[model samples]
Target: MTSARDIVPISARLLERLEALGTPRDRVLAHAGLAATTALSTEQFFAFWRAVEEVSPRRDLGLVVGAEASERGYSVASAAALHAADLAGALHTLARYKRLTCPEVVELEVARGEAHVRFHWVLATSEVPRLLVDSTFASFTSLARRGTAGAVAPLRIELARAAGDAALLRERLGCPVAFGAPVDRITFAERALAARFVTADAEAFSRVVPGLEAELVGRSRTRSLRDEVRLVIARKMSSGARPSVDQVARGMHVSARTLQRRLGEERTSYQEQLDAVRRTSARRLLANTDLDPIDIAFLLGFEEPNSFVRAFRGWERTTPTRWRARVARG
Candidate 1:
């Protein structure tokens, strides 16, 4: 499985919303068990949501925060979109820059007289939580409502999970909400995209583009050696072969000794990284797929199903079958 970089930025909008509600950013991070202030991994992002749930008094935490963020949306993270000529341009800008924030894919397509927005958390091992989903959809609608003239509302909303607290969504979004769908989507009026952004400043937006582009390029060019090694290992494992340090290093144009030294500087060894990858990949396969332990063993390049089970027991303290069953029950 492909994993994301530490891509999810600690968004100002989320922190500011909590602060406005009289909660400190530090407090939330503390409650979330997160020490990193710069960005969150995809898993850590979920922990952040759990923190918001624990600290906030409002039952509609996601709705309030996401909507309010739209009211004063401009931030260094979104300087380009703040001055886009129209809603379409602003959304396009945000979409372009989303890689700097999170692993999720934000798709905005206007088709058949409707504007459809979809999100794909492609690398996630499990379900995206309801609160995160709500906040995301709410942010988009609120942005539209903030930017456009007169009353604006989504035509329809669809969610994949149970409808707990969905009435709050209807009240906040002013639309019919449907749940238990295969995918989540929000449908808006098509003309809304063409509506001019009330905040647009073309000149300012143009200036920020080059700097943001440079930052994005820098991110692409400087991916972590650990992540690169992980990907190479995954590819080799999927091809039914175990990749050694030497083979992995050769692929990256480095000597095995040099790779070991570099990884040591990163505070890890090749075997350590390999075990970490196997642990994560094993759990992900167990949780997300119906593949049996034997088949999964093949994919992980294990010599035998029993060997895979032994390693999984060491990592998770349960048989793969039991773990899968427990996850299913949840």
Candidate 2:
């Protein structure tokens, strides 16, 4: 799993909205372990939300916040969307550049005279928070309306959790809302796909998108072969499956022999990559979270807690409990 420290910061607009509602920016930043000038982690954002819920008595808090937030609050991703020529293009831009803001997954699927735009939390557990679900969809709707000057609205909204007050939901979302759906999604008429964006600037878009793509590529290039392998390993571990060398090779679109040869050039092997990531992850979890060793072991894809203990001893020269105690001391 991607650690909180590594996830991209929440959108600037959402941050601004929170502060406008009397949530102190400094307090939120301090609680999230973020500097005022830097982007914050999703974990920090969640903490901020919890604080907002506690202090604010507004029953329509999510609606108020979402109604006020739009693409302009999204920073670079907003820029990409504003410059795109049409509604569909704008959404495509958002889907591509949104990771620059947050790690949530956005998928655009067009079929059967409607477009299904889905939002999913990458770091979510089984219980998805109501605040997160509401804020995300509300912001999405606001952005779309802003881009097209209210020329489009969703045909329907599908939420994974139970529906709240129907009248209030309709008032906030401007659409019929359905609850207990399999996914969090918005459906729009096919005609909306071709609707020209009121903010479209073809020239600006042409100028900005390439630079963004170049910067993204440059960042990716900075990662070593070892780093990529570690990332693949971490992802597999998060999904409760330990990936094999052959599987990783295929995932990377390389032959196993070629992948091994490349690793050899860096004086490492697949096993070394796995071990290093597991050790680093185990240490991070032990230090930062309250998860037991057995839970951490399962999260790291170890079949048994005993095996994890044995490996932890080899890596740190101490048991997990002792290692955690030393970490606490320091």
Best by TM-score: 1
lDDT of 2 by residue, 43-89 (tens): 55566566566655566777777666554455577567867778888
lDDT of 1 at 147: 59
Q: What is the C-alpha lDDT of each candidate?
A: 0.73, 0.72
Clashing pairs in 2: none
TM-score of candidate 2 to 2 decimals? 0.62
Alpha-carbon lDDT of model 1: 0.73
RMSD of each: 7.8, 8.4
> Which residue pairs of candidate 1 clash?
none
Name the runs in model 2 displaced over 4 angstroms.
1-5, 10-16, 26-39, 125-128, 221-330
By lDDT, the best candidate is 1
lDDT, residue 131, candidate 1: 71
TM-score of each: 0.64, 0.62
**Candidate 1 lDDT for residue 268:** 88
